[model samples]
Target: MLKKEQFLSYSAGAIVAGMYCGKLELNGDFFAGYEYGTGISPSLDPYFRSEMKRLEKEAEGDLKSYCSLARLMFYKGNKPKPLVAPLLIDKP
Candidate 1:
């Protein structure tokens, strides 16, 4: 029985993941034509800025969901989930 806010937050995380993936795919071509190689165009800059803010909001929403889930599980006497590990680790 997840709360409405929890479900909405999960959906927001999916949307943010999709948005970032799409941005990464287009960045190369979209940025290739920009002047000074800074990848910022007069027309695209505003759109990019807005997208960044949206992404941040979505990420915050997801964090809230995770925290809520963690708290719920803790109160239920369940162990906390392990943190996700880094993809690459250096050997000593």
Candidate 2:
């Protein structure tokens, strides 16, 4: 069985990875442009916003699944493991 600390660490890492990936997918280009003072395209604003919302939802779902799996592992007495594998596995 994974130690408590190990499990917590795994969970934390998973959460951070999920959030970061989500952020990148959602606002990567916008943030890059904003940082470089590039003006936003008016025509693309709506599309960007819609895409961001979708990305955010996807990220949240990913995070929730990560947490849920972590909880299950903990309950099952499985050893604390890296977060990447679980996240990479497809879910139906």
Candidate 3:
């Protein structure tokens, strides 16, 4: 198991790397635009929005509550009238 600080550090690095990767890919595509003999349209807004939303969702949910394969299976099998992932099923 990783120490708390180390885990946090790695997580931050991963997020930063993902964001940086997206930017790099977009930049590379921009430079390679002439391959198709047409101007490439730059659109990073949606990508950035999706990344922000993903980060927000992760921040809002607790890892403990989101994890546990056994618990997830139990809830999946015994889900009320409408079956859904345990993580998404709202508690009364």
The TM-score leader among the candidates is 2
**Model 1: CA > 4 A from native:** 22-92
Cα displacement (angstroms), candidate 1, residue 78, comes to 22
lDDT of 3 by residue, 1-92 (tens): 33333333323323333333222111233124322343322123344445456644553464333223213322323445212222112223
Candidate 3: what lDDT? 0.32
How far out, in Å, is residue 4 in model 2?
45
All candidates: TM-score: 0.26, 0.28, 0.25
Candidate ranking under TM-score, highest first, comes to 2, 1, 3
Encode model 1's per-residue lDDT on 1-92: one tens digit a residue.
Answer: 33333333333333344343222112222223332454334334454455556656755677655343333322222234312211111112
Cand. 2 TM to true fold: 0.28
**Candidate 3 residue pairs that clash:** none
* Top-lDDT candidate index: 2
Worst 10 residues of 2 by lDDT: 83-92
Rank candidates by lDDT, best first.
2, 1, 3
Better of 2 and 3 by TM-score: 2
* Candidate 2 global lDDT: 0.39
